[model samples]
Target: RFNQFFSFFSRIDTLGLNNFIDPRGYVQIQQIMENMTINRLEIRVDSLYMDLQIQILGLCRKNNIRNVVITVNPGGMIDQFRNKLCTESEFGVTLDVCERIGNVEGAYFGQWRRFWNEMDVYLRKKGIKMQMNLCNDNGFDHDGYARCGVRSHIRCERMDRQNMGVIRPISLSRGFLPK
Candidate 1:
């Protein structure tokens, strides 16, 4: 059964799987790389499980895996486990993990923001770039209105003053909106 699943994945370069999948299932996938190569592996987990994540990491190491993407939901548990795995594994596998924290009313958004910022700096230090997406009703403007080139100087100054020394001055009007 596992082999069949692996066979199916063998034909594709990208594979997405849930976090609670059996470790043996991943191992079987690793075994079937006879003629195929997987460039990217994405795993979405409810929370990070050290043992299971380590098993996946081991497979990646053995298979000469190049890129890995892991996504874990809210709470610090998954982030903690991910840090542990990175620390424990000596094998160099470039990993780009994204952890999305749920937006709950009155939640500690400041803390999570700081945590993600620190994580980014840490990864940058290690020559790895980690992308974090924090979504909240107020924070995320999916319509790109806030990011548009119509920013007023008053608003920019207000934001600068509010952010103090944290927010850097840039050409926000030109580059804020994504094409």
Candidate 2:
């Protein structure tokens, strides 16, 4: 049934998967990705294991998939893990930190602050570009505020962006003033 479900399809521009967790999540997601040939893949970073995320990236590389987009929900202690995504991978990186009206475990200002600031420090050295609220949320309703976070992804292939772009990421030291 599964093979037949995807057999006819040869390719897709993007494959988006959400709500990934340990119990039985990675296996199912792994199967789908292995089965389908996708141009770009989007994984919603709700509450997934860090290792599983790396495994998924490895699978994409093995398949020669081009892009892997990670839309991180605001409430995770992912600064350290995200550092791995940026420096260790042999690919360019982009980050978009979203600010919402309410606080949650994974999607709050502190995690956002930690991740973004760390990236900034790395950016000065690696010269990777970062953007904020760069993606449109596809009209999905969100908690507290209706913000569709920005889009940035890992690449299996090489890219040459040339220079830094977009406004600098938010900084608490300077004091945040939301418009």
Kindly provide the TM-score of model 2 when superposed on the true structure, using C-alpha atoms. Answer: 0.56
Candidate with best TM-score: 2
Point out where model 1 deviates above 4 Å. 1-11, 32-36, 76-96, 99-101, 105-111, 136-179
Per-residue lDDT of model 1, residues 1-179, tens digit only = 65555566444455556665577777666676534556656666656555667667666666555555555544423435336554322344444444343554332222445665575566456544343323343444334433332111100111112222321112222233111
Model 1 TM-score on a 0 to 1 scale: 0.52
Question: How many pairs of residues collide in model 2?
Answer: 6
Model 2 ranges with Cα > 4 A deviation = 23-36, 77-79, 92-101, 104-115, 133-159, 162-179
Report the lDDT tens digits of candidate 2 across residue range 42-126.
5555543567656665656544555555545434324355455544334543322233333453324334446655655565456
Residue 4 deviation, candidate 2, in Å? Answer: 2.4
In candidate 2, the residue pairs with backbone N, CA or C atoms under 3 Å apart (3 or more residues apart, or in different chains) clash, namely: 74-106, 74-107, 75-105, 75-106, 75-107, 76-106
TM-score of each: 0.52, 0.56
